[model samples]
Target: CKTIFPNLFLIIHRNIVSTVNLACPLDLKSIALQARNAEYNPKVLSYSAVIMRIREPRTTALIFSSGKMVCTGAKSEEQSRLAARKYARVVQKLGFPVKFLDFKIQNMVGSCDVCFPIRLEARAVSWIYRMVKPRIVLLIFVSGKVVLTGTVGI
Candidate 1:
């Protein structure tokens, strides 16, 4: 016999990863010096990218010389997009001709607690669960908690 618990889970998005293209090459050294909340250490990553952070959305962005940016630490898709735009705006304000292009939500991570113990041995699949969608993966624990990752959308 099997039991179904309907509406037993409420997932909270923990992190959202997104990418954006600025559509213009960036001068990392200039950005590092001119932009506030920006950090760049050539010895650290060999001048590959500049790391910028914003406090409002609490997100971090990796900005590359090719005008590519990756934003992370947002809790929702909207926040992720907003943060990316904020980053673009910062660069644009720095006198760079930047256009926000190809903003994409690369991955989302969420977790939930069911409030009951799950018997993993009974399922015989161990702890890791892969969804039909190639990008999604779930981790089920005996404590009835689940972590879902790599989802592109809600």
Candidate 2:
């Protein structure tokens, strides 16, 4: 199912078993929620790492090893970056050993096609093709093989 917040989007996986998935925006409020309710913790939780990606014009995804994630849409690069830093801070304050100063940004791009028409004397003749703007993709992975994907607008 999908949940929409003011600046966050969440996709959750619900099964009556032992696996959960969450994705939300890279905002302070949303990040706090995910960090709190993602998994079962007898003691406090510590964050291993935070990763960021610039995937498109307005989309960012963040994944946590606690089986929590945040996907923020319709944001600028600066907003996304700030949100990420804030999230890392929150995790650290929760007594989790968050090492965010070691984070970095990665860029990704790809191509897409659009269709156009060619006209003849009385009928359409051929189709035309074009390339789409490049997209950026960000990935944050904590320890233990958990991958986080974040994207921000260019």
Candidate 3:
């Protein structure tokens, strides 16, 4: 579900996620051992990160040992922030001095159908010429479906 404003462009669905700094290093395996919802596999990609999930916003947080955490899959910016804070609190309660910092909304994706057919090839060329800024990535389908993603506002 997504919020809609009359003045804004059509948004079918949106994903708003945040990246936060935990301020202290973590022990991935220990976290996995302590938290029932967390899973860590050292054999997977050889990365030291704990995969965590929360059901309220139905998001996933990638908690890394380097004091960095990325939370994804929230439907709105507010939900993303709340979910991130919830995660930080969870970790803090788990005995880590997890201070929520640098909480940045990393990505928001929105899609809509124009209710008309489109020539994707022509649209792609046109969109490229239409001046894309630093962060946005867009995809246009022949069915006039559009997906736009960026770090900026939705």
Compose the digit string of candidate 1's lDDT tens values, residues 25-126: 999999999999999997888558999999989999999999999999999889999999999999999999999989899889999887777887766534
TM-scores of all predicted structures = 0.88, 0.31, 0.84
Clash count, predicted structure 3? 0
- TM-score leaderboard ranking: 1, 3, 2
**CA error at residue 110 for candidate 2, angstroms:** 14
- Which lDDT value does model 3 have at 65? 94
The local distance difference test score of each candidate is 0.90, 0.35, 0.80
Superposed Cα deviation of residue 125, candidate 2 (Å): 18
Off by over 4 Å in 2: 1-61, 66-71, 101-153
Query: Rank by lDDT, descending?
Result: 1, 3, 2
- In candidate 3 the C-alpha lDDT for residue 137 amounts to 73
Worst 10 residues of 1 by lDDT: 1-10
Model 2: number of backbone collisions: 14
Clashes of each: 0, 14, 0
Output the number of the TM-score-best candidate: 1
